[model samples]
Target: MDKFVTRSRAPVEEQEVELGNLPADPGLRIPISDYHPNLKDKVRRAYLQKGACQPSHNFKKRKIENLLRRFNLNWFNEYKLWLEYSVEKEAAFCLYCYLFKSDNKQSGDAFVKEGFDAWNKKERLDLHVGGPNSGHNQARRKCEDLMKQNQHIDVTLNRHSEQIKNEYRIRLGASVDCLRFLLRQGIALRGHDESDGSINQGNFLEILKFLAAHNKEIDGVVGKNAPGNLKISSPDIQHDIVNASAVETLNYIIHDLGDDLFAILIDESRDISVKEQMIVILRYVDKRGHVIERFIGIAHVPNTNAASLKVCIDSLFAKHGLSISRIRGQGYDGASNMRGEFNGLKSLIMRENESAHYIHCFAHQLQLTLVAIAKNNVHVGSLFNMIANLVNVVGASCKRRDILRDRQAIHIYEALAIGELASGHGLNQETTLKRAGDTRWGSHYGTLLSLINMFESVIDVLDTIVDDGPSSEQRAEASALLEFVQSFDFVYSLHLMKNVLGITNELSISLQRKDQDIVNAMKLVKLSKLRIQMLRDDGWDDLLAEVSMFCEKFNIICPNMEDNFQMKGRSRRKVHQVTNIHYYKVEFFYGVLDMQLQELNTRFNESNMELLLCMSCLSPNDAFAAFDKKKLIRLAQFYPNDFSSVELMMLGNQLGTYIFDMRSDNEFLILNGIAVLAEKLVQTKKDMVYPLIYLLIKLALILPVSTASVERAFSAMKIVKSRLRNRMGDQLLNDSLVTYIEKAVFDGVLNESIIQRFQHMKNRRGQL
Candidate 1:
C-alpha cells in the first residue's frame, strides 16, 4: 500500500484565479471634432462596452454657486438606461448616442462627440428627454431594443441583414402573388400537361411567369436567370411556402385563443379516392360578439369507428400543441359514431374533459326532425312524394325545363297585365322550379314556394304534356297527375304545409345562423312554437277560405263544411257523421302541428336549454345585460377539475368585480365576440386579478356554437384536394387548405419574413 512515490509529497496546491471586471476607461481627452468618424466608432465601442467610468471624486469641477457643481455623481444613478459619464474629459455622454447616433446636426452632438461639460446647466437633463419624436428618444429606443435578448444582433442578422431582407422580400413577394392567384380563382396548382411546349402549366407556374415577365427585378433573380437552383417556383418550394403561411395563420388563431377554453367542430367524409378523412374547425365568438369559424385542419384516418376517430383526434391535437382538457364543447353530426352515449367521439372527449359537452348539430337536428315527421305522418309524407314526382316528370329534361319556364313567363306576364300580381324589381325576374330532394328538408319548402309562385304555369305545362302525348302512357300519366293536383285535397295539403313548415322553417333558418346564441335560440324556439299554436287555434277559417278560392279559380269542386268526409278513392269506407271540418282540422292539422312541437321539444330538451341559457352570460350584446355572476359560477362548477369548490366560491366575488370593471373600462366598451372579450380581459390585467372568472368566460367562449365550420372545411376540402388531386398527401393538403381558407392572415405576412424562414430551413442554391 505504501509503494507510491512519497518523495514529491511537498505542498502542491493550485494557484487561485481572478476574474475582475473589465476596464472602464473613459478614453483619450481629444476634442470631439478632432476624432475622425471612423475612429470615433472604435473609441466609442470600447468605452460603451467597458461601461460608464464615473470617478467623480477624482475629477475637478466648475463652481456655479458657492457649492462646486461637479458632474452630478447621482445623475449617473438615474437615466442609466441610456446615460454614461466620462471622467477623462470632465463631462458626461450618452452611452447609447455615442455608439449609435447617426448624425451630428441634431442637438449639437454635445453628449457624444464633445461630452457635455456644463455642470451648472444640469437642468439640461429635462431638455435631454425632449419630445416623443426627439433624436435623443430615438437613440434611446435603439439602445433599449438592442439590449433585449430577443432583439439582439446575431452573425446572420449583422453581416448582410439589409441585403438579405431586400432580396428575400422580392422572392417571397413573387411566390405569394402566385399563390394568391391560384387561391382566388379556385384553380388547381399542378398541371398534367406542364412542360415547355404546353401553353398553360397550371395556374401557379403561369402566374409566376406572368409576374416575372413584367417585373425586371423579379426576372433578374428568379427562375432560370436565378443564381444556382433558387428558382423559388418549384413544386416543393411552392408547397413549403404555402405551408409556412398556414403555420403563421394558425399561430395567429392560437394567439387569439390563448389558454382560454375553446370548442371544436368536426365532420368526416370520403375523398375522391375513397379515403375516410375528418375535417376539424374552430368556432368561437370573437371579442366583437361575431361568430368566427376558422377551418383548422384535416386528419386522415384508417377508420371512422368511435375509438379510431378519438385516437386520430388526439394525435391531431398533440401534433398542434392543443390540450384536450381545454375543450369546452364538441359539435358533430348525429351519427351514432359521433353521438353514441358510451363509445362515440363526444363521450370519449367528455371522459377526459367532462365540460366538453356534446352538441348534436342544431341545423342537422332540425333537418332530421323535419324528415322524420314527414316520413312518419301519412298525410304530409304522401303529399311531398307527389310533389317530388310531379317535379320530376314536368322538368325531366332541358327541353321540358325550357317549356316550363316559357309557360311560367307567359302566366307571369298575364298576371302582371291583369293586376293580379304586383310588378316589382325582383318580382318579374326569370325563375325556374327548384326540384325537391327527400333528404333536404329545406328543398321541400323551396319547391312548394316556387310552385305557388308559378301555380298557373305548372298547370299549363301539365296540360301541354297531356295533349302533346309523346306516348299514350305519358299522356295517361299526365292526365292523372293533372287531375290529382287540381283536387281540393291537394290544394288543402299545399297551404297547410306551407303554413306549418313556414313557421318551423323560420326557426330552422334562425337556428342555422352562424351567430346563433343560446339566448336567441331559446327565444326563436319559443316564438316559433307560439306562432304554430296560434295558427292551429285560429288558422282553420283562413286556410279553408284560401283553399276554396284557389279551387274556384282552378274550376275544382269545393266541398261544403257541414258535409260528411269521404275518402278520395273508388271504394270509400268512412266513419259515419264525421264533418269535413272535424276530419281535416281536428285530426290532420292538429296531428301535424303537435308532431312538430314534440320534435322540437325532444331535440332541444330542458337540459340543453338550461346549459345554453347559462352560457349566454358570455353574450356581449345589450351592454352585457345577460351577464350573471351567479350563473357564471354555476357554469364553472360544471368543470370541477378546473375549478375546485374553493375556487368556485371565490369565483362569485371575482365575477362581480370583473363585470363592474369590464363595464367601466373604456377598452371593453366595444366588443365583438367572446375571443375578443378574453383578449381585452387579458390586456386589462383582469385575467390575473380574477383567474376563475376568466376561466369561466373562456369555457363559455369555447362551447360549440355550431358545426357549420366543419361543413365549411369539408366544402373547402373539395376545393383543395379535388378529384384530380385526390392522392395528395395529408399534410400537404392541410397546408393548402389553411392558406386557401384564411387568405386574410396571409395577406398581412411580410414577404421578406417567409423567404428568410425558407432560406434558414436548409441550404439552398440561391442566397435569398
Candidate 2:
C-alpha cells in the first residue's frame, strides 16, 4: 500500500490537550474508495439485486437486522440509521442516542435486493420494488450518502488551506529578504518606468498594480468581476507589508540605539478637514555616538489642547516601550497653551519629571520677537498696515488678482530673456503676493521684493486700472497705494526689514551647519551684529525725525512716547550684569524721571528733592513744560480733548474724595517696605522663584499662551496628510505623526511604572 504515514506507528499517548495547543495523533490513513469499506459493496449488491437493470445480474434480499449484523452495527429505527455496535451505547439509546448520533452512525436503512436475478423484464420490475427496505428508506440513504461525500470534500479543502498558508508565509519571508537585499546593495525602493533602464516582476509598481486589480497575484483575473487588464498592487495588503517592514526597521534601530538619553521633537497639526494630528521625531545617540534624527511616526489627538496632546504623546511612548523620564529637552512653537508654566502642557509634563527641560523653539521665538517689535512701534505698525491694505485691495478682486499674476509671469519671462536665472545664493523666487485687509499685515517682504523686481508689468497694469472709471473706494484706495509706492521710506524700509530678517535666517542655518560652515557663519553673525549697531547709532535719530515729520505732514497725532517702569518687576534681577545694567538706566529715564516722579511730588510731597532732580533730567530744555498751558486750556475749552475724557472724570472724582492722613501715609510706606521684604524673602527661594521666573518669561515672551501653536501644527499637518486619508481615526493618525515634531523626550522613558500602567489599560480594553 502506498500509505504516506504510520509505517511504524508508536502507541500514541492520549494526553489531555491544552487550549490553543493542537492534539498530537497519527493521522488517519483511510483508503480513498473505502472510507466506509462495506458501504460500497452493499450498494453494489443492492444495485445488482435491482438487477439486470443495467445488464448485470445478481440478487439478494435481507432483513434490516441481518444487514446490520453484516455491517457489525446495531439498528435504531428512531435514528433511521444502523449505528455501529458499541458497548458505550448499550442502554436506553433508542430515542436519546438517535438525537446525538455521530456522523458515522447517522444513517438510514441499508440497500437490499428486491428481486432474484433473471433474464426477464418482470424480474427488473420486481427489483424496482423494495425487498426488505422501503422506497422512502432507499431515497433517505441516498441523501445521507451525498452528505458523506460532501464531508470528504470539506476535509480535502481544509488540508489545501493549510498548505496555502504555509506557502504564503514562505513567500512573505522571501519578499522581505529580497527587500533587505536591495537595501543592502544601496538600491533605493523607488519606482521607475521600463524606459528608465530597468524592468522587473519584483518592481513595486508592477506588484502593486497587479495586486490592486486582481487582489491575488497568481492566475489572471480570478473572478468574473476582476478586470481584464488590471494594474496596481492591493493597497490593503501592501499597507500590511509596509507596516510590518516599518516595525521591523524600528526594532532594528531600537536595538542599535541601546541605552542612551535621547530627546524627542514633537509637533502636531491638522489636515484640511481640520483633524488634529501629531508627528514625532527622535534625536538620539547611536552606538557610534553620532546624534541621529529619525522620523518615528505621525499621530492624531482628540483636540489641539495641551492635555489632549499629552495623552496622545503618552500613548505613543507606551506603544514604543519608551522611557519619558530620560528625555533631556523639549522644543515647540510659541503657544501659551503648550508652554504655560501653570497648567500648560509643558508644566504638566515637567511636574512628573524635572529632567525634561523646555526650550523655546529658536526660530519661532525670533519670529515672535520681530512681530512684537513691529506691532509695538506705531510708525512701523502703520507701515505694515498700509502694505497689508495694498495687498488686499489688489488681490481681493479676481480680475485684479489675475492681472497681477500675469504681470508677475511676464516679468519672470523678461528676466529669463535677459539671461537672469533664479539664484540660490540669496533670495530667489518670491512667494506669491496675497491680499491683506486694513487689519492684516502686508505680503511677506520676500514676496514684495520679488514683485518689485518684476515691477514694470505690474506698474503698467496699475496704470490701466487707474485710468479706468474705478469705484470711489477703489480710486481712493489706489491713490493711497500710489502714494505709498512713491514714498522713499516705504521703499527703503521694505528692503531694510527684509535684509534684517534675511540675516536672521542666515544665522539660523549657519548655527546648524557643518563645523567649518558654522564657524564661517558665526563670523558673518558678528559682522551682522556690528552692522545692526551701526544702523542704530547712525540712523535711529534720523528715522525718528523722519517719523515725526511724516506724522506732522499727515496731521496725525504722534502716539505717546512715555514708558512705564515697575520696581517690582523681575527684570530688576537681570540688571546686575554689566551688559544688562543699562536696563536700570533706561527704566529710570523712561519711567521714574519721565512722569511718575513729577506726579508723585505734586500729589504727595510738593517739595520732594527726588522729584525735582528727576523733572530736571526729564526736560533739560523744558520743551514739555514750556508748552503753553493756557493755549492747551483754550484748546480744551474750544473742543473735546482726551484730558476731559470719561476716564479722567472718574480719576478726578476719586482724588477729590480721598482723605490723606499721616497714619495712612506711614502705612503705605510700610507696605512699600513689605514689598521690598518680599523680594528679599524670595532671594533664598531660588529653587522656586528662579525656575518660576524662567518659566514665566518663557511663556510670556518666547511662547504664545494661545492656541496659535496648535493652529500652526495643524497647518503643517494639512500638507503632510491630505485628502487621501483626511478622516484618519485619532489613534492611527497620532501614531503616524509622532515623527514630525520630534518631541525631545519620550515621557515613558523616565518612569517604568507609567509604561506598565499604560500597558495595563491597553490590556483591559482588549479584553472588552
Candidate 3:
C-alpha cells in the first residue's frame, strides 16, 4: 500500500467518482495501470464502488458439437461477487482480478486479459480460484482489503501524506511565480549575500518572503514548515526556473513564427568580458499580418570570421528547428566577412538559397555616407576637427563645465529680460557639449546643434581657460580654439554642414524604424537627394546671410561678399584674386553638397533602386495607385521558389482581379501601407482569395530595411552582461537575455507552463 501510487493523489472523499460516466464494458474501459500514476487509486476505488457489470438481457448462442450453448446469466450466482460481463465483447471477466491485478502478474489469464466466455467449462472458474498463494486469490484478498477503508491508522497517514504533497506544490509554485516576475523585469535574481538573516537575500528570496507574508497558505509551507531539501530557493533552482522561462518564451516565438519565411538580422559585438557574441533577430509577418521582429538568441563565437559565424548560425537554426532555406533575406553591417563576394555569410547562404538577398543596413550605410562625404572635403574636415578640440577644451574639466553652464544661464537670463530670447518650459534647458563619435555620424550632428546653442558660453569658457593659465599647453590650446571660432570660414563651414545634416537626419531616422518598408524608404532617399541638390542650387545666399549674422552677433568681423577672397596664413598679394562670393558659395557650399549627393547616389545605386522600385509597386498607398502589373509580376520572378512559372502566369491573372476587387471596396480605399493592406486582406478573407499576391506582400515585409532589432539586442546584451555580471556563463547569459529582450512574447507564456517545463527538465525534490 505504501508504494501503491507513485504520484500525488487526492484524499479518498475528495476524489470524484461519477458512476453514470464510467464504462461498463470491461473490454472498452481503460486498464487500471494505464491511468496516470496519481489517478490510479482513484480509478480503482471508482470501479469498486460501481460493483460488477452483469446484465440480465438475453445472451447470444453458440453451437458447440451440434449442441447450442450460450453465456448463462445464472453463472453470476455461482461466481457471485467477481463475475462481470462486457456487453460490447459478450465475454465474462473477473472483477477482482481486473481491479487488483499487478501489471506483471497473469494468473487468471483468460479472465483478466482476453475475457472468458466458455459456457460449458464450469470447472474453470473453480480452478481459477486456486490456492491462497495463487495470483487470483492474492488479487481477491487485496481487493477485499481495499474495500475495508475503515482502518483509522492507514487513513490518517494517507491524508497526512496528501497534505504534504499539496504543501510542496504551493511552495514550488511560489518560487516559480517569484522567478517569473524577476525574469520579466530583467532583474538579477541573486545577490552577493543571500544567506539567511541577510537583509537583501536577493530579488528571488525577498520577493518570495513578501508573497508569503500576504498569503496564509504560502506562509505556512515556505520557510520553517517546509522540508529543507524542498525549499526550492537555491541558485540552481533559480537558474532552472530562468532556463524554463527562456525555453517557453522561445517556443512561443517559434510558434508565432509558424511556417512562414523569415529574414535574419544579425550583428556581432564584444561584451564587457570581451567575449565576441552575435545576436540574431527574426523578422516575419505574423498571422495577423503585423511585421514582427523578435530577438531569438545570442551565441558566443571565438572569432567573427565568415566561416565561424556561418557554423554558429547553422547551429542556432538547427537547435531551434529552423531551416536555412526559409531565410528570404540577410541583413548585416558593412563588415567584409558578412557581405564578402565569395566567402561571406550572405554568399554562403546564397549558394544554398539564391533568393536570400543581402542588404547592408541602411542606417549604417547613411552613417558611412555622411562620414565619407564630410571628411572628403578639406574645409568640412578641418571644421569638425576644430569643433572636437573646442568642445574638449571647454568641457574638459569640471571647473570648465561649470563655467560654461553658469555663463549659458546668465546669457539666457539676460536675453529673456531684454526680450531677445523666448522663455518656455523645455526651452533653454541646461545642456553641455556633446563629443562626436567616429562610428555614429548622428552624434556629429547633435554635437553641431549643441555647439550652435552654447556658442557664446563655449567662447566664454575658453577665454577663461586662456586667462587662468591652468597650464601653458591648455592656455595655448584654448587660445587656438578661440581664434578658429572667430574666423568666417569656421562659422560658414559649421552652418553649412548643419544644414546638410539636418536634411539627411530625417531620412536616417525614418530608415531605422522597425515598421519601415523598402518602398517608402527609397522614396525618402530620393526626397533627401532632391533637398540636398536644392540646397546646393539655391541655398548659398541664405547660408551666407545666416553665417554673417552669427559672426556679427559674436563680435567677429564679417567679410564683404564683393571683397577679394584672401586665404588664411597667405599674403593678400600672393593669393589669387577671387571674389568672396565665389570662394564661399562655389568652393565651399556647392563643393560639400556635391560630395554628399555623389555618396548618396553611389551607396543607393541603380540595382538597389530597381529592386526597391519593384517592391514599391505592391504599395497600397493611394488605393493601390502605385500597383503595376508588370512590376509586381517581376517581383514574383525574384523569388522563383515561392512562385513558379505557372503560378507567375496565374499571378498575373490574379493581380488583375485583385487590384480591381480591392479598389472597388471602401475598406481597402483607406489602406495606407503594405502592412496595413496585408492585415485588411486577412480580415476580409481576401488573402485566401489572392494567395499569390499575399505571398508577395509577405516577401516584401520579410525583406529587412535595417538591422535595428539586432542592434537593440546587442544593447540589451550590454545591460544583461554588464561588468558586475561579467562572469555569467554563456548559457545563463543567453537565457537571461532572451527573456529580457522578448518580454512581450514572454509575458504571454503562462507560469504553469514554465513550472511544467521546469519539472520535466529533470526530477526535482518536490512536484511543481
Candidate 4:
C-alpha cells in the first residue's frame, strides 16, 4: 500500500527527482522521485483499471458484488461502496416499478430477449469504455435478469392488504345498496330477498362474524392452517368500522323522521348457547298514521338487572345523540326486573324522565294469566303433570322414542291412504314448551294440549313398554300412567287448553295484524281478559268438583263432605255475602284468584277496565304516587277504588292548566295533550283515545328512550364488511355509512353538519 501510494502521490514543487536520481544519504533517500509526473499518472491509471467500474444501477451493483465475492478482492471495497449508493437509489426506483410500473409479461419478455443477448455478448469493457453505452447496458441487463427470476413475488407481500380492502368494498357496497333498495321499495326485512340470488344466502352470519370480531380471525371462521397465499384480514378493524357505522346510520334514520314519536319494544331471551340478549324494536307512525315496526338491534348483556339494562340502554342513546327527555313510554314483559314498581327498569327510566311509563307486554301478560288459572285448578294442574310425566318417560329412552315415532308414522300413512289429513298428525317438529319462572308456573293448558295431540304415539309407546319390556315394577308404573291418561281430569283439561289456546292465538293474530280495526283490536284484547277471568272461575269450580269425585273414588278424605261444615266467623276483609263460608276456603279461593290475575296480566293483553278493576279489587285503598297534576286529579276520583264526577272535573281543570301553559309551537305539547286525553278516557271509557293515544305515547318513548337506532346501522355495516375484506381505514368506513343513512331528508334538514360534528369530535379525540 505504501509503495503504490508513494508512486502515485502528486509531485510537490520541491521534489522533482526521478527514480534513477535519488539522493545517497539514507535520511535524504526519499523515494519522492518515484512520484514524478509520468509515474504518478501511471499509478492513477493502474488504480482506476484494477478497482473495476462502478455501475449507476441497482442490478449492476448486485452483479458486481457477486463477481467481487467470487474473486475475493478486498482492494475494490471503497469502489464497491460507491456503487452501493447508486444501487440504493435505483432500488427505490425498482420498488416503484414493482408497485406501479412493471408488467409481469413484459418483464418476463425482457428476460427472454435481453438476457440471451447479454449472456452471449459478454465482454469486459476496455479502459477506454467510458462512454455512457457501456455502463447503461450493464445496468439494464442486470435489471432484466432480476425481473425474470422473481416475476410476481415482489408484489405478493402487499396482496393480502389489497384483497382485504377489496373484500370490504364489495361487502359494504352490497349491504348499503341492498338496504337502500329495500328502504326505497318499502320492503320488510323478512321479505327483502334479492332477485337473482339472495344476498344473505347463509353468509349473513359470516359477514356479521367479521364485524363482531373486527377484522380478526375469529374462532370458527377460518382454520389455523390457512395458506400463506390466502389473504384475509383480521376482523378487528371491521368490527370497529361497523360499530361506528351502525351508530351513524341510526342517527340518520332518527333525523329523517321529525316531530314523530317512536315506540320501543324490548324482549329478552337466552339464545341457543345460553347467551342472554335483549332485542330492541322500534315502532313509529308514518305520515299515514300507520304503525311500522323495525328491529333495531340485539344487544348482549351481562345480566337482565334493571339498573344494568338501563345503563346499556342509556349508553346506546347517548352514542346516537338521542335524549331520554323525549321518551314518552316504555314497553316490557312482566319480568320483575323490568316492571317492579320500586326498582324495575321502567321505574329507573321514569326517575330520569317522568313520562317513560311502563306497560306489561299485552300478549305475554295474557299468556301468564291463562297459565295461572290452569295451575290454580287442581284437576287441570294434575292432569297436565301426568301428561308431562308420560312425555318425559316415552321421550327418555331411544326405544320408547322409536316406538312413538313408528306409531306417528303409521298414523300419518293411514290417514294419507284414507284421503284424510290426520287431525292430530305432524307432532315431531320442534316445540317451545311453556317455561315456568319465579312468579308463575308453566301453562298447564299448553302442556295439556300438546300431550293430547301426541296421545296416540304416547299411548302406543307405553303399551309396548308395559307388554314387551322392563320389570314388573315398570309394568305397574305403566298401568298407573295408562290410568292417568284415561282419567276424566286429563280429558277435560286437554279440551280446555285447546279451546283457550285457540282464543289466545287468535288474539295474538289480531294484535300483530297491521290493518285490524281499532275497535276490533280493543274487543280482542278485552275478550282475552274475559277469557282468563272465566278460566279462573271455571278452574276453581272444576277443581272442587273433580277433587271431591277423586276422593270418593280413592276412599280418601271427602273434600265435599268437609266443605259441608262452614266456619261461623269469616275474615273481616271479605264481603259478607254468606257467613256460612269457610274462612280457609275464602282465603284459598282469593289466593288462587290473585295469583291467576297476576299471571294473566303478564301473559296477555287486558282491557283497561279489567286491569284497573283487578288493581282496585286487590288494593282497594292502596296509595298510588301522583307526580303530575293530571294524575293527582285522576287519582283523587279513584281515592276509594271508584271514579267520581268530582274527580273528573278536577282532572279537567288540571288539563286546562296544562293546555293554557303549553306552547303552540311545541311538538311535545301535542303529546302532552294526548296524555291528558288518555286520563280522560279512563273515566269516559271512550276507548277510542286510549288505543291511539297509547300507541302515540309508545312511539314517543321508543324513539328517544334508547339508542337502539344504531343497531340497524351495525347490521348494515356487517353486511358491508365480511371475512374476505375486513380491514378498512376507520375514516373511510365511517364515511360510507354516514352517506348511506343521510339520504333521507327532513323538511330540508341535511345531516352534513351532524356528520361533520362527529368527524371533528373523532379527530380531536384521536389527537388527545
lDDT per residue for candidate 1 within 47-143, as digits (tens), equals: 3333444432334457767767666657766875556654335667775665556444664577766677778887897687789877788876755
Q: Give model 4's TM-score versus the native structure.
A: 0.45
Residue-level lDDT tens digits of model 4 in 1-768: 011212243454433422212211111112323344444333222222222222211122224434421211231242241111111122211111111112233333221111211211223212212355433334344344433322335334333455454443434333333333433232222213322245653233334334435544333232232333321222322233333344445544554444355445665654333555565555555443444545444555768888878765654443232445445446665678977888988778777666444555544555556554656666556655666667666776777767777787786677667876645555335332232232222244455555655666667777887897578877887878977766544554555556555557667645544322223333466776686567656655655565455445434343233344343235655645443124323544445455655655544343234323222211101121112444334333422212257645644564444433333324323332222333333444433333432332223223222222333444445543334334433333433434443334211322333323222221111110
Better of 2 and 4 by TM-score: 4
Worst 10 residues of 4 by lDDT: 617-626
Query: CA lDDT of each candidate?
Result: 0.68, 0.38, 0.79, 0.42
Q: Candidate 2's residue-wise lDDT over 104-142, tens digit each?
A: 333231111111222222233233334546453444454
TM-score of each: 0.71, 0.44, 0.77, 0.45
Model 3's TM-score against the true structure: 0.77
* Superior by lDDT: candidate 1 or candidate 2: 1
Q: What TM-score does prediction 2 earn?
A: 0.44
Model 2 lDDT on a 0 to 1 scale? 0.38
Most accurate candidate by lDDT:
3
Candidate 3 Cα misplacement greater than 4 A, ranges: 1-160, 439-441, 569-577
Error of 2 at 11 (Å): 44
lDDT score, candidate 3, position 695: 95
Q: Which candidate leads the pack in TM-score?
A: 3
Tell me the lDDT of candidate 4: 0.42
